[model samples]
Target: MSSNKQPVINKFGVISSSYYEKLFKCNGQNLYKSRSGKSKPSYSVTRECILKFNHTENLREKERLKEQLTKNILRCKRRLGLRTLGSGKHVNIPGGWIEATYLAQCKGDIQEEALNVLYDSLDHASFDYCQLPALFFVAESVLYRLCCDAFQKTYLYSVEMKLAKIGYLVFLRLFVFFLHGHLGGFKAHLLRLQQYLNVLSLSEETYYKYPNIFSNVAFILKTSEIIYERVLLSESTFSPNGNTEGYENVYSDMEFQRHLRFNQGGYEVNHLLWHCVAAWSCVQNNSPKLNNVLEHLNFHKTQLQNKCWLDSALALLVLAEAAKLNMVCLKALMDLVRDFILSIMSAQNQEESYKVNDFSWAWNIVYTYVTILAEICLYAATSDLRKTVFIGFCGCKSSQKNISLKDTVSEDEPVLREASVLGLLKYFSSKISENCNQLIWTGYYGLVYNLVRMSWELRGDEEQNGLRNTIWQTLQKTKDHEKDERIRIAVKIAQAELNDPTDPFTSYGTKVPPNVGDETLSKYIGWRIANTLSKLFFPSIDACAVPLKKLSIKQVQRKYPKKKEDPMKKRVLHFTVREHPSKSELSMFPYPDLFTRVDEQLARIVDHHWQEELKIRQKEDAICEAEERKDKELKEKNHFKEIMKKREEKLHKQTKPYELPPRTEVISLESKERNVRKVTDYRFSTKIVQLQTGILKLPPSAIQ
Candidate 1:
């Protein structure tokens, strides 16, 4: 394994050089670089083209930009070794979108493989928001947008009359997931999908063929679209809907008695369940709509209890947000999570070793549930981020205070911080420390990986709280027993991170302040670790294969600890990262955990220190201001004498000076003072200006 500087624990090994670089050569020049200079990173050109395509308003120019972007994407796909279908008109391929392009896609079986990776990438983004999803979506968006662009440019005729492109199928898959619809900021990703689908819903050609299949897709599509727009509309304002503020019209509600379902089984879209989730997210302490949204949410309380993929995803999202709000929606989530926790406990009770496929049915629901719950626990337990709370509630200071930071617990709570998240950590820890660790490792690798990542991230006195022991035990056991070489390699990387004190990943944009206490420093490191939590969730290649992936870093490789050395003996852990990573993909800072805020206690300490420093500076500045005032008085006396001397010089130069006479510095009293403006400074007032003017007209006797 390479040193911490390189992302050595990569799930998918780095993408290497490819054949597309020569195909997109502009003006017959080398695509790699100018003969005289360095070239742009692979992603740089494609990203620039995407930005241009979106921003350019000119039709011909926009088309040209789209052409260039298409080429860049194709070049990247080939570079990443991803399959591409060139263009449907590429002569070899017949139907559907493939790879990174909208107009043409890689063939079916190959595209299915790519699409799996794409879905995993999408889930990862909604889960942790790492840098890779940004890359993946950039390419994904271009493909979709270009396909939409081709709706006008290319032929829609097909022999079967069923529909030629399968791109809308991709849109259906994403629309079903809500793609961070729980968080409410994933509008950009879904925005293109809705537009394309809306286009198809209206298209005469599309309706003429595949009418039945697409109608089902369109019905759900419009319903989901309205729900997102309603929730997002609340986010757009400082006030609730129908306020006397910006826009008055409330988003019209779409109604469906029962969720629409297909004959293919369990594939259902519940308008009510999803609508409630959206409404609850926008509900605030003083929201005028809060009572109404809650009323609707409770009305659908039965659907919330029912087990479905949509409900499960929405439940997990609410559970996470509940933790942030000190369980604002605890009553609602307790019912959902109670069953979830039991399932996890049940999975553990199994004696025989089972592969993930042993219970393929349950794995789908439980794997995502555990991964996301583990994420909630990790952020809540290790980092000071929980102190920041939700952004929506911040505006209501009185309302914010009503909510507590700690969980509401009984007297006999576990030894950990009564935060339920802490207990969950102990539960995961018990899995490692106890004998049945093998059960979880197979079915829940993401959960195992998240725990180890949490342990490494909680690099302080906090680790002594049972986490340190569990992490060490897991790493040591995996080094010898793990069959998957990737797991073994990953375990070794964890071991290296623990042993190497000089790691670059340790620093998370925080500097150890001068004269900082041990407790404060520990808290500060917890704050710093918040930035790197996303790296632990590395699931293969995140973004599309771009030139940026080919730009590799030279890192110092890691060597295993010696047999003679004490493995437990440790050097101090350091923490921070570049605060402002470059806009380019070459920047090493992971994007997912970038926005974790400072914890309350840490914020208070820094604020206190800042206030004291501000006072001392104020005192020093007072003394300096007095000294400057004395100097100004002395200078003014000398200025009067110099002015008289200048008068003599001006008197002598009046006959010959070529430069224009000095402009009047004084305002004329005869000139009208516009509209009753009052003078705030008496020092600037001229005696020549009479009291009759707006500068506080002086009395007649005072004037005399």
Candidate 2:
């Protein structure tokens, strides 16, 4: 509520402040304090340390606690999977999967309470800590499971149905957490998880399944460690016992098996998904591995028919990756890409709501498609990017084609001048109009790179200079108004690439010009392409740019009717905290939303904290002002004292008498030493040559 620039810290309204204060206060204390002369449970110790790690005010203390826990886990692993007290007492919390079972058994209120505890603990975890990413992974997995449960029970109209909605909020919060931390270390988890599942095989099921079945917690811990290693030491080593031959064997033989069923729970899908990801990871120019993956992916195209949205999104990403590898002919792949885009766009149109669930994979799909489009523009053969095709193949409406730019070719031409460029821009602009900020922000960088690259590649109307400028200006506005620092930084980097002269867009310092050597430029281009696509799955802040429109501004305004507001009409809907009913008064209502009450209470706490913070700020400002005034007076007094000292010194100097120089005497030199020294000296002789006289005579004649 206050305009002050300081952060507001609300005092706890329902929960006591000491609850959090005690967490921070017990930074280095042993968890098993002798309460009634008996030590506490292992879970208690773990929870206490985790809380301390989460809330400790001192960075050094937080690190010490984190290192202590890490050491404990490492020691437990080293001791033949036995928990022990080596340097200090340690505890092992239940793994995410095991915890899920316990969560399922808990009653509704207990589950909500437990979720809140986990939320608070995970929310406050140090962003830079090595363990935070794995923690987020576990937390998200658990939250997803909870969400599924709530969704399944929603039809029953039980109290638990309301709890399901909280999962989405938790998901949003978790996403915001990553945004704040720049999604630190999560990429490695993604990569490692992909690698682990990629090499897993039904043939070696016993090896992988035994540990997971018997001791799931340890398995989870081991997986977390491997992921952390992969993230922290990416180039140091590779996963041992990868099933390259087995994966190929399964891909080749599994489709024809008589007993093969598509209903293998989520395994078959996950297996395929991981393989696609791994193949994408291992992609190289004209790679045989990529070719094989593409063959397998083509075989499973039918399997993609009934898959869930998340799995479909993964398959699409793999397809985009394969496209980048140039595994197939451009024309055929372009048609496939266009058809897929059209299908997704169609699905989006048919959907009535653009809620979180409906738009879950929207960003990922757009990101992948944009990346593929960029790749086509950059790396496709000259014939591919510039080849003219019937406008029907691109799925653009006739009206869109009719609205032409000033320099565009005639509509009677019957074919697109640059089919790929026109199609990609039209689709991109439509998607931009949908107001999916996450999708736009994620894909904006790659779009910029492609636009600049295409601007260099294409000339005249096909160059799309106006669209490029508009998109860049849109991103500029988003960057200026965006709240999330991570997104702002990413936008700034993208802008630097597009607008900064010294920042060569490609890593190899390849200038954005045509006819550059492809070998060096291609590698740098490949990296930018890959990195641009990778950051899209993560989310970010919304944009403030005008919605992209297919029609010209003048035409659009002409089509729609404008209305003037009546100043006499009164507004109907309004809310104020003062108008809210007290808890006692609300108890008589037949149905009351507890969630709304909690939200209002939290808001009240925030307002109170803001007012308190404003008062503190005002006090601090008054103190500063007094100090400044005192300092000013002191400085003036010093200046005056200095001036007076100088004047006194000047008067003292002016009052002093003049002085005179003393007389001195000079003595004459004696000649006795000159006669004494001549006794030991030898005489010197000199001679002159006769050739000089001849030269002087010749010179006089020459002058005349």
Candidate 3:
């Protein structure tokens, strides 16, 4: 049988090839049949029947049916040893009573047993069968019970479980898909869970009454944390030559395959770490035993540095709630805020990671919130502590940009740099603005406003005037260059605060005000100075002094020409071929006295020009040498082609020919000389020639 063909069942009940293909296309029909044939309906079919019955009737009728179904589910769940109703025990029930009991109990009231059954379905029942309709029935039951009167007491407890179970169900469903290689499904499930949580609001009574449900909330949070951690860890592990050390290195030798296997089958363990903190915070807010909850929160803070990603956001939310409730100590809350800001700064410096694109924007907004909270907290604290906290919070340098004088001088600094500056300004501005408003509301506006009024009155000195001018120029330049609305607003606010006589921080009542004649102008001048100094020292302590020599416009223009037309248009004439001097040419040219004078002058000019040309050529050669050195260093550092020369050398050596011997002649002579003794003449010939009288002497010639 072809592999692609469907399988067929034989008389013996064995699945044949023809039936396999048919079953494959039947949407898990073969598994359903096999399970049913073994004497029980598949969970899927049972769930389907329940769903069909659920939608066929009104709410009261659905509840009646749900009670019956719940009994059957509980029986099946108990048979599988699943925990129900938080009892940590399995309830045994007859199969016949399960469905009928669930429907009867669920009618017009939340059935705790039905909720137990639903929770069990989440835990033990097959998701393919139990997920969708189970969530719908559970949601409907909880929603209805929350509104119903008779079930209020029981409803609260069961509803918490139901909501939590639904959350877990959604999480698990996502987990299953993620494990099954469907990332989109997992994301969709996560989004749905988020939406559900957004709509969910627990009454204070419910929150305190069911604190244990916080565990489920924690589970949801832990799921998101785990997923994010897994992704980070996976990326780190697979990264080429990635440094696996410290906490990250712990997974180096761990067998991911086995871990993946366990996690794959266990989808119920989807705990989102952030959800846990959020739940705990919720409980802490409503719980009467606030001290204990706060203590518990402090303990959880230790885990935050390692799982800082979500914890930071949670901490902010918790602090915001604390502010709203007016439940926490000002000092303690400020400490938390301080620690959070420090952590964020450290993380930004160490990781260069952004939870959002406009980190500066986010930072400023969050800091503004923190400052506002801190201001309120400060007012709640003693005067000494308020000052300390105020200075500490405002004085902390921004991580995005170093506060240095150079940065202030350059208007075109990077966005982060500008953001850092603006962040500081915003912080100070918000503090003063809020304090001013408070003062006004509290009837201390006259005292506070006069203090700021005094600062402006005192700034009539020449040095202060210059400082003011610099500041005004800087602000104008920044206003022109900055594009972000938040930064621009912040800058405008800072500028206004500096100029406003009622600016509480500056205007805090003083002993005396400036002379009336200079008050208005001095205020303007003082603002300019303060603004300049603020920009110069913002985010950093570095101060840059403008160079004195380059300060004047004429000096700058003299140093750098605004136009190069004359120099650029100047042309030089050069001889294309060298002219040779000849005596005939000179005589024919008949040099005149005027020509002689011109020739002498031209000769001097040529000599000077040649010397200058030689000097220029030398400089050009030096520049070329420097450039070559730089290029060589760059290539060596790159390293890719460095081994090519050695490879070529090796190939050449292998292919080289061996050296040959010098040419030689072989001498062969027949038997000779000795034959003369046998009557054969042996001749030894030696010839000497006599030269003519005029010929050169041969060898060492004897006398003729």
Candidate 4:
């Protein structure tokens, strides 16, 4: 062998060189090597050689090896008196005998002898079967087989002991997984047991004969209950650690456990088990002596509710089943649930109130109980009995003012909670026909309104459609048209479909004639007529009517005024009347008529001002032209005066002005004074006319 051929080390860190040499040499030869002379080998050496030879074999060889191994282990146990009580023959035990015995027991029927053999193997103080994973696997398999085989037998102490041992083994496996940080394995083991129990429960023969199976069933239930309680209690505390806070970690751990249990059939099994136990106890004890069972169930329920964790709905359902089994004390149990529901519904303070998600679970529980309560009432014989129980359950006075439809749903309570309460009332009404009239009327009407409004708002989609139809059918039963306006509104909205169109606005097919009498019809019509008349002619009716007719007459007179005798009088009449129309006519004319008159007068004023402005402009033009001509002449005269002055100065410089030339003066066709007066008069007249028209011609832009 080369130096690089490294030896394989065990956990103890030392490899047996001879062991490897024999192994490699056997591999090369495809045959085993003997320790001494090549004679028949010792039993241990033969076993090792067979194992090494069969390591590469297929299924046929593997099964052959398993049978051989089983034969050897059983032979050894038999020789040592491990299969019998007080036998003197003793034989040394082989390694892996525990696992071999477990497998052998699982492969066939576990008879008394096999059980005795297993017991003897396990009883050794130095036995290490529990530490071996393969031993657990083999033991679980054998236990499962044993349970199936014994499930049909009569109650025997030995069978019960076997079951107890199997259960203990299962528990040990779970604990090992937990301690070793193999949570997945732990959950898988739990699930495996859960499935095993379910199969056990399904066997009616097992349950009927072995009433003590409750012990094994209780083990599973109690394990789940304990884990759930820990989870619930943990959620209420704070965790300072990083992975999860204190209570949160507890919750997480429990939740993980719960997932295991639930996935493994914990819910169905535990609930059924509790009821089965209670029922069996009832029959066996010949009395409702379920205090022990009830106490255990209640402990978990109280924890669930107080912590507001775990599915309260599922817990309540289980409790209700148990309560049903022990019906003698059902009222007290029911009262406890009722109080829980009411307290959750009434939690108004922000801190006290359950979170929205929590409330959903709480409501589910309450609603379920409410349903159960209704069933109980309906099954009662007499109306009086039903009524008494219903009133007691509701905790409201019979004579108290019923909640009206007009009263808004409280903000603190969920809509589903309100719906549930109404459902209860409706149920009570159905059960106690004679005494439930008031409740029926009030509850039915309120429900109709709520459902109708909810439908209109499209809150619950398809669900609300169903509710709307239900309310309609319910309304038909009561036929109380006077009290329920929602019914009336629904009818009116559906009236167009009296002929039964394919669709009604209410979407409830077509309207069916309500069973109302002529008296009711007459009263309804009379009320409508009175309402209309009062709205038409109430306070100050005379004042409005008198002004209306007088204004009409004034408008007629103003629109068709009598022809005036004189033209001047006609013009004055027209101007004065147009300037300020009659107030009565203005007020009475429809808004459009008043607007038209104002528009015409504004147009006329604009035209008059336009003409006056044109005349003033012409006169100004004439006067400006005349002034320009005069100013030109004045300029020429000044130029001539300058020439004369320059000539005189030159002449004096020589001798003197010799008889100054005759002075020439420019002339005009019209006098400046006369023209100024004519222009001023023209400007004044234009100014007066413009001023008068400007007073009448407020801008159309302003009106707009």
lDDT of 2 by residue, 12-53 (tens): 101122332222112233223333536442221233444456
Write down the lDDT of every candidate, Cα atoms only: 0.37, 0.38, 0.36, 0.38
lDDT of 1 by residue, 14-118 (tens): 211232332233333333453245774334333234344555679899667656655644444443322321222121110111223322222232223333333
Question: For model 2, what is the error of residue 689's alpha carbon versus the real structure, in angstroms, after optimal superposition?
Answer: 99
- Looking at model 2, the pairs that clash are none
Q: Give the TM-score of candidate 4.
A: 0.22
Model 2 Cα displacement at 218 (Å)? 28
As a TM-score, model 3 comes out at: 0.24
lDDT score at residue 267, model 4, on the 0-100 scale:
23
Residue 479 of candidate 4: its Cα lDDT?
A: 42
Query: With candidate 1 superimposed using the best TM-score fit, by how many Å does residue 550's alpha carbon deviate from the native?
Result: 34
The true-versus-predicted C-alpha distance at residue 284 of model 1, in Å, is 4.5
Candidate 3: list runs displaced more than 4 Å: 1-75, 78-105, 108-110, 120-158, 161-194, 201-210, 218-704
The list of candidate 1 runs beyond 4 A from truth reads 1-173, 176-268, 271-276, 282-311, 330-335, 343-359, 374-419, 425-447, 455-704
Cα displacement (Å) at residue 363, model 3? 25
lDDT of 3: 0.36
Q: What TM-score do all the candidates reach, one by one?
A: 0.30, 0.28, 0.24, 0.22
**Per-residue C-alpha lDDT of model 4 across residues 321-367, encoded as one tens digit per residue:** 33333443354445556455445535523434546524433432343
